[model samples]
Target: MLSGQSFMMFVVLLCTCAFAFLNGFRDASNSIAVAVRNRALTPTYAVLVAAFFTFVGTMASTSFGVYLVSAVELGVPDGIPGLALLLSGLLAGGAWGLFCWWRGLPISSTHALIAALAGASGASALLGNDGVHDAWRMLAGGVLLPLLFTPLFAFAASWVLVIPVTWLVRHSTASDVNGVSRAGQAVAACAVALGNGLQDGQRTGAMLTLALVTAGAAQPGAIMLGPQLLGAGCLAAGVLFGGWRIAHTLAYRLVNIDPLRGMVAQTVSAAMLFFGAMLIHLPISTTQAVTSSIVGAGTNQRFESVTWQQVNKVLRNWLATPLVCALLGGILYLAMHPLVS
Candidate 1:
């Protein structure tokens, strides 16, 4: 029979894998929506391409994984309470992702998880598990700041890019332009999928490692290859399943996008994801970056034709996601603590 701590660790690990699947299910559209919209790739092929690249990216590097583990581990207590906190956080994030996916609303799984972790940490602190200082510190520098800046930066950058891209291709024939744009969209879509894999794969890995360490099954800074590969496989499976509800919303409801515009939006979002992961060392939401970029690029040509109602709805959901996940995390942790203890 498993010890209480060992059993709790196993539960947390299972929850972390489920959370990763939700992340990929909801965020897969960020990469394939535009490409599919322009007929650059059929829906089936798109998912396959996305799944392959996502797996590759997840296994690509552990830099972000290490950073995330360090950032989150320091915040919670060790042993059973810590395991409960992580489980609560995972459930909170996964719940929000499912709700949003059902409603076809684009949301940031990364932001939701971060908010949920912080809230669980806060709740644990309230019960005198420990203080909230470390959790607060991690959220401030990692999630909140990126939440504020990434959307605006992605939008502005994509909007401006349309101008120059249009200018360069102005003289080209329509067929020629479409062909080039289609090709570009295909490449950019793969790049975005790769980035998403890198961002989210590491997050799930970190959570799993945290659970093991808290349970005394592993040591700090000891990341095992088996867990990383398992997380990546789960993520890739989710990508293959795809989130067509969200995909339709992004492809048609949010904006009127041509091949050129789709290419521009995806390219900008990919750059931001890479820059965040490698250079600035922050997690950027694939949903926020890609959705905002599409809107920005759409508005460049005919602002009136863009779907304001849909834009407003998506924005409202984006704002609500973190708050909802945080509350849920706190509530779940409080509710589960008594039983676990």
Candidate 2:
């Protein structure tokens, strides 16, 4: 007969899957917020579109993105031996994401996943080296990029983008400019959704796969297509549902963004995320990217127009994101450790 201890470990893995579902529910705010708020699409339709892309992206990539994020970095081994770490990670990430959502503070699922992975792996390293180097690499890819470049680059990139469109209006014929701008807005918004799907969806896939590994159902080296599908499906559905409150904040409150400015910021942020997902295999936060992009574009409009208070609020939450996740994960593990063991 299977050992009782083994069965408990399986329960831990199930919890990890539960966390993946929460990630979908909590982070759904990121993709559809802009589309729904802009009146480009109804909230329901926006979420549907977002959900479809998230599902496609998460399901398509097997071993990449979320799986690697959830599994390899936290020192979780390929097989069933890694349950504690995996469950700890999912718990950490879910708590962090939920906290942010409750506060109506937009933090990146990318950031949450990275921090949770670190906490799990860091704690696990106390036992022995399973696979923490990947965590360090992830630190570079996920956190470092957002911290170093997102605000600066996103800000600058948005301005650079806006300059051309503004200039085109000035230099080109004015007769059809409004129609052209409107058309451009539609295209840009859809592109942002696509880009976010390519980037963020992969993280969902990674997390789902990690859940399977926690249960000993798969190896880190092996790909679980089922988990990927579930992750993608949840993420996309969440996006389709959309977070109306946060969307309102991002669309109107963060900065005084008109349609053209919003388009540039969204597109630039999406591009950064897409490139990171494809090339760096790094998970970047669309929340940070878009916010920074908006700040960037806003700064160009007038230094005074950019809302420093809003940015600070976001920064404070950014600082809080990892701390909360780590603390919660450790506590949850301690409380459940004996039961799991």
Q: Which candidate tops lDDT? A: 1
lDDT, residue 328, model 1: 93
As for model 1, its CA RMSD to the true structure in angstroms is 1.5
Question: Candidate 1: where are CA atoms >4 Å away?
Answer: 63-73, 131-133
lDDT values for all models = 0.85, 0.63
TM-score: which candidate is best? 1
Model 1, span 1-341: residue lDDT tens: 98888888889889888888888888889999989989999999999999999898888747554246442455557888878888888899899899889999999887888788788888887887763347777777666787789889999999999999999999999999999999999999999999988777887777777778778888777457777888898899899999999999999998888999999999999998888788777888889999999999988995454788999999888888778888999999999989887
- What does candidate 2 score on TM? 0.85
TM-score of each: 0.96, 0.85
Please provide, for model 2 over 1-341, each residue's C-alpha lDDT reduced to its tens digit, 9 standing for 90 to 100.
76654664656646655655555555555555554555556666666666665666565555344323655655565433356655666677777777667767777766666666666666655545463457766666677556667767788888888888788678666446645654555565556666666666665666566656655666765446676666666666566556656666676667776556666777787788777666767666777787788777766774577667877898888877776665665565555455544
Model 1 residue 252 distance off true place after TM-score fit, in angstroms: 0.8
Looking at model 1, residue 91 earns an lDDT score of 94
